[model samples]
Each structure stands twice: as structure tokens, then as C-alpha cells.
Target: MAQMTIAEALREALREEMIRDERVFCIGEDIGIRGGWGGAFTVTLGLEKVARERVIDTPISENGLFGVALGAAIMGLRPVADVQYGDFLFNAMDQVANHIAKIRYMSGGKIKVPLVMRAPVGATGRGAQHAQNLEATFLTIPGIKIVCPATAYDAKGLLKAAIRDDSPVLMFEHKLLYGSKGARSESGAVDASSDIPDEDYVVSIGKGIVRREGADVTIVGTLLMMHLALQAADRLAQEGISAEVIDPRSLVPFDWELLEESVRKTSRLVVVAEGPKTGGIGSEIAATVSERMMDYLTAPIQRVASPDIPVPFSPVMENFYRPDVDRICGAARKTIGD
Candidate 1:
């Protein structure tokens, strides 16, 4: 076992998957260039040496690049299309929402879009154009699967699984949670690193893992916000507030059973997310919890999320824009007051 960051772990997964399957290849901008930033981060660095032809580099055309992946997927090739930024996903909306997601269903389940779109998300002082969390954008989509891995272990495991999955999958990686290093390192990075296994592993999509177990309240979060929830949980523990922290690694195929069971145990729920409050991921979780576990709730469900506004450019305002430990802890306290 070795300690690894999310970026290193994902690179390893891609390398392993490409070696295991000749059909697997990466298609994106700056992925294979020597001394270049690997697809906006270093996740694809040094991949060219492993599979020269498979490590493809493309022009700065998100729509065109994504379309090629869809075409390849239709022909039974697994292509990992990398978008430079999550916000740039808007450029390829038609390809993703219209084509890649609906190919299998439109073909009456005869086709499989075994394609993966990797995008780096979350605000890292890059202003609005590059910082948006796009998970909420695809929650309602029928065909595409969404996975957001917060830790190094899940990042590697989930990426491996996504490569093998037969449907279109969107992988949203958080900038701060990447634990990136060198020139591509983030200034205010969070250490979500973990000791990855020596053997091959795959974290099945649609399953949620409980990071911390408690009985007073259940706190749900994903990606960067998942780390925030764990921080809040620690503080809440200091105050004698037992809060359970859950990481819904796969957002679309949400682990409703895990959430429902945790909510039932705690009888209180507070969801934390980095995106805006309106139509945020918390909205769906809160709604589902109310629908399925309302009987177990002792108080109204609370949500700790950003305001319905653009992420601020200033670091202080950015911190204020997103949910923090104090906010989450307060929400938890409000949900289950002493």
C-alpha cells in the first residue's frame, strides 16, 4: 500500500485500464504532450509512454472532441474524453445531454456508450468561468451516470469502474480535493490522500460510504464539500454532537438506501454542498429524504450550501460563498437542537 493523492491515483487507474483493455483510450487536449499540463491537471501526465497511440491529444474543441468520443463509443471503443474545466462542459452540452446520454436508450438498449468525460470542478480562485460544480446540472439526465470521488482511494477505484461501465459516465473532480503537486498544485488544497491498495479494485458506482458514524444527525456531502462535512463533524463531536458523515460517491445512481438508513438512525439530516442552494444536489437529497424517511425525522431537514450567486473572486468572499465547518455545524445543531 502507498499513500497517494487523487490525481496520482486516477492516473494509475487510467494506466491500468488502458493496459487491461485495448479498446480503452484517452481523448482530450494536452493529454499526451511532453512537458504539458495533462488535461488541465497532471492526471494524464506520462501516459504517452505507456500507450503512445492510446494517449491522444486534441484541439481546444470541447464539442468536437466530445462528439468523437460518442462516435467511438458507438463503435464499441471506450474513450475517456477530458474537458479542461467543468464550466467548459457547457460548450459540449449538446453532445453530452443529447447524444452521449441517449445513445443506448435511443438504440433500444442495443448500444452502449462506454465513454467517460473527466472534468475538474470547484472554485479554486479561478473566478466563475472555471469553478462551477456541474453535478447538479446532470442529475435529471436519464442515461448518463455521475461519479464524484472525494478521496484518493475512491478516485482510483471509481475511475477504474467507470472505464469498465457500459454507459456514459461523467467524472467531476474537485480542484482543491485533487491534492495536486508541482506547477499544477492548488494553493488552498485539502489533503484527501489515502493509502491505495496494491491489488486491483473497483468501487461500484451508486454506492455511498459512511466516513463517520454517529446517531445525533446525518450529514451528507460529495466532492469538496464532503471534506467540509467531515471537518464539521469533528467540531460537532467536540460539542457533543454526534453527526454521521456520508459520501455519495456516485450522485446519479444515488445511494438512497444508505442515506435513508443513516437518516433513520439519526432522526435528523443536514446536507452540505458547494454549489448554490437552489436546485443544488442538497435539494434532491432533502426531497428524497422527506419522501422516504420523514417519519424518522425529529426536526426539519436543513441545507448548508452556497447562495444562489456566482462564486466570488476574492478568497474571503469565496469562503463565504461556500459552506464551511461553522455553517454545517450550525445547520446540524439547528436540525437537532439540544
Candidate 2:
């Protein structure tokens, strides 16, 4: 096992995937440039040296990037497309939402799109344009799988799995949880490193992991919010709250079985998401749990998320804009009547 950050583990995953499969390649703006910030967060830094021919750089066009990847995937190439920011995905919605997402389904399952889309999300002083948590937007879109990795272990494993899967996978990485080092380090970065195994492995997509087991309430979160939910669980334990924390790493094919089991055991639920409260990921989870497990729930499902506004540029407002441990703890307490 090797201790590695999320960025290092992801870089290793890309390297291994490219080596394992001849058709696997990476395409993005500034990704193949020598000494660049590895597609913004250093995940692809130094990868051009490993497979220079496959590390294809493109113009600053999200539409063109997705178009190229969509065509490549249809032609039996596994393309890992990178977006410098999660918000840039809006620029390529036609290709992503229309072509890449529906080509296989529209073709009656005769075609496959083995494409992996990677983007870094969360507010980090990049303002509304560069820092949107896009999980909700893509989750609503059908025919695409979404995976959000909070730890280095899951980061490596999920990317490997997404590359191997024959479906278009949207992988969202939290900017603050990347654990980038040196010049690429992010401010207020969380310690998301893990002892990754050297052997080949993959975390199954559409599965959720229980971060902390409890009996009073189930707290569900993803990406950066998952880490904060764990911290809130620690604080809730001190007050005898017994908040169970769950990280639904894969959003599209959500692990409803694991979530149902937790909600049944806990009898209460609190969903924490980084995006706005209205029509957010948390809202979907809350609504689904209420619909399916209403008989087992002892209290109403609670959702803690940002307000219905664009991400603020100010660091102070950004901090207030995202969900924190205090907000998670408060939501958990409210769910369990603490």
C-alpha cells in the first residue's frame, strides 16, 4: 500500500488505465502541456510523459472536447475527458446531454459510449462561474452515471471502474478535497489521502459506504459535504446524538439499498449537500427516502444545503454558502429532535 493524496491516486489511476487498455487516452485543454497544472488540479500532471501520444491537448472549447470524446468513444476508444471547472459543463450540454448521453439509448443499445468525464467542483473563491457543485444538474439528466470520490482510495478505484464501464460516467471531484501539493495546493484543503493498494482494484459504481455507524439518525452527503458530515457525526457523538454518516459516492445509480438500511436502522434522515436547497441533490435524496421508507422513518427527512443563489466570490460568503459541520449537526439534531 502507498500513502497518496486524491490527486496522486487519480494520476496513478489514469496512468494505470492507459497502460492497461491500449485505447484509453486523456483529452483536455492544457492537460498535455508540459509543466501545466495537470488540467487545473494536477491530477494529470506528468501524465503526458507516460503516454504522450494518448495525452491529446485541445483548444479551450468544452463543446469541442466533448464532441471529440463522444466520437472517440463510439469508435471504441475509452476517452477520459477533463473539464477545467465543473461549471464549464454547461457550455457542452448539447454534446453531453444530447449526444454523449443518448447515443447508446437512442441507438437501441447497439452502441456504447465508454467515456469518462472528470470535473472539479465546490466553491474555492472562483465565483459563480468556476465553482458550482454540478452533481444535481447531471443527476437529473438520464443515461449518465455520476460518481463523487471523497477519499484517495475511492478516487483511484472509481476512476478505474468508470473507465472500464461501457457507459458515460460523470466523475465529480471536490476542489478542496483534491489534496494537491506544492504549487497546486488549494486553500482550506481537507486531508483526503489514503493508503491505496498497489494491486489492481476498483470500487463498484452505484454503491454507498457507511463512514460512521449510528442508531439515532442517518446523515447522507457526497463529495466535500461527506467529509463535513463525518465531522458533524463526531461532534454529534459527544452529545450522544449517534448520527450515522453515509457517503453515496455514486449519485446516478444511487445505492438505495444501503441508504434504506441506514434510514431504517436510524429512524431519521438528514441529507447534506453543497449546492442550493431547492431541487438539489439533497432534496432528491430526501424525497426518495420519504417516498420509499416513510413507514420506517420516525421523523421527517431534513435537508441542509446552500441557499438558492450563485456561489459568492468572497471567501467569507463562500464559506457561509457551503454546508459546514455546524449546519450538518444542526440538521441532524433537528431530524432526531435533539
Candidate 3:
């Protein structure tokens, strides 16, 4: 067993995958350079050592880079494309949503786009553009699997799974959760580093991991919000109110059975998200739960999310805009009739 940061864990996953599969390679901006930032957060740092040709770096062109990756994937190559910011995914939406996502289904299952798009999300005081939570935008499109890894272990495992999966996968890593070192470090970064086993393992996609178990209510979150939910759960524990924290690692092929079971046991649900309340991922989850298991719930499904307005530029307003542990705890307490 060894301790590693989320960035290191992701790098390990890529390193192992490239070694295991000849078809697996990386394509992004500033990746594979001698002393680059490693695709924005240093996840691809030092990968040029083993597979320089496989680690391809391109210009600052999201659309062109994604187009290249999609073309490569169509030719039976596993291409992992990295975007500096999750928000920039909009630049390549056509290639991602139209071509990459629909190619397999449109071709009547004749093609397999085994491509992984890695993007860093979350409001790390990066103003409006870079701070937006882009998960909701992608959740609308079909055929692409979405995953948000919350810890170093999950980062390694889920990334391995994403790389191996036949369909196109979108992995959204939170900027604050990367535990990135040096100049790329985020100011509000939480220590998402974890002790990872040296043995090879893969966390199944579409599975939710229970970070903390409780009886009062189930708090569903992903990415950085999952960490905040855990913190809120700890604070709730001090008040004699138990809170169960669930990280839905994969969004598209979500573990609904697991979430339903948790909701059935807790009889209450509070979904916390950094995205906007309207048409957000949290809204989808809450609606699905209410539609399927309304009878099993003792309280209404509450969502604690950012306001619909753009993320504020001021740090004071930004902190207020993003959902915090206090907001999550308050929502959970209200859901459980505390």
C-alpha cells in the first residue's frame, strides 16, 4: 500500500493502461512536453518517459483536439483527451455530443468509441467561465458515460475503468479535489490524497460508494460536494443526528439500486451540488428518486445547490454562491425533520 495524491493516482492509471494496452494513448494540450503543466493539473506529468509517441500534445484547440481523439477512437485506438477546464467542453460539444456520443448507436453498434475526456470542474474562485459546474450540460446527452471521482483511490480505479470501457467516457475531476501541487494548485483545495494499494484494481463504473453510513438521512453528492457532505455528516454526528453520505461516482449509468436502497433505509434524501438548481444533475437525481421511491421516503427530496446566477467574482460572494458544509447540513436536517 502507498499514499498518493489524486493527480498521482490518475497518472498511475494512465501509465498502467498504456503499458497494458498498446491502443491506449493520451492526446491533449501541453501533455507530454518535457516540462509542461501536464494537461493543466499535472495528471499526465512525466508520462513522456515510457510512451512519448503515445502521449500526444496538441495546440490550444478543444474542438480540434477532441475531433482528433474521436477519429482515433473510431480507428480502434483508446484516446484520453484532456481539457484545461470543464467549461471549455462547450467548444467541442458537437464532436463530443454528436459524433463521439452517437457514433456507436448511430452506426448500429458497429463502432466503439473507447475515448476518455478528462476535465477539471468546480468553483475555485476562477470567476464565471472556469468556475461553472458543467456536469448538467453533459448529462443531457446520451451514449457517453460520466464519472466524477472523489478520492485518490477512486480516481485511480474509476480512471482505469473509464479507459477500459468500450464507450466514450467523460471524467470530470474537481479542481479543488485534485490536490495538485506547485503553481497549478487551487487555493481552496481539499486534501483529497488517500492511501492506495499497490495491487491493481478497478472500481466499477456506475457504482456509488458509501463514504459514511447513517440513519437520519442520505446526502447524495459527487466530486467536491461529496467531500463537503462527509464533513457535514461529521458535524451532524456531533449533534446526535446521523447522516449518510453517498458519492455517485458515475452519473450516466448511475447506481440507482444502491441509491434507492439508501433512500429506503434513511427515508430521506438531500442532494448537494455546486451546479445551478435549474436543470442541474441534482434535480435529475431528486426527480428520479421521487418518481420511483416516493412511498419509501418520509420527507421531500431536497437539493442544496448554487443559485441560477453566474458564479460571482468576489471571493465573499463566491463562497456564498457555492454550497458549503453548513448548507448541506442544514438541508439534511430539514429533510429528516430535525
TM-score of each: 0.99, 0.99, 0.98
What are the lDDT figures for the candidates, one per model?
0.92, 0.92, 0.91
Off by over 4 Å in 1: none
Single out the weakest 10-residue window by summed lDDT for candidate 2.
Answer: 30-39
The candidate maximizing lDDT is 2
User: Residue 216 lDDT in model 2?
Assistant: 95
Candidate 1, residues 1-338, lDDT tens digits: the string is 99999999999999999999999999999988987877688999898878899988988999999999999999999999998889999999999999999978988989988999999999889888989987898997889999999999999999999999999999999999887788899988999999999999999999999999999999999998899899999999999999999999999799999998898899999998888899989899899889887788999999988899988899999888878888998999998765
Shift of residue 273 alpha carbon in model 1, Å: 0.8
lDDT (C-alpha) at residue 315 in model 2: 88
Higher-scoring candidate on TM-score, 2 or 3: 2
Flag clash pairs in model 1. none
lDDT for each residue of candidate 2 in 93-152, tens digit (9 for 90 to 100): 999999999999999999999999999999998899989998899877899999999999
Q: What 10-residue stretch in candidate 3 is worst by lDDT?
A: 31-40
Model 2, C-alpha of 195: deviation from truth (Å): 0.3
- Cα RMSD to the true fold for all candidates: 0.8, 0.8, 0.9
Error of 3 at 163 (Å): 0.8
Instruction: Please give the distance, in angstroms, between residue 139's alpha carbon in candidate 3 and its true position after superposition.
Output: 1.1
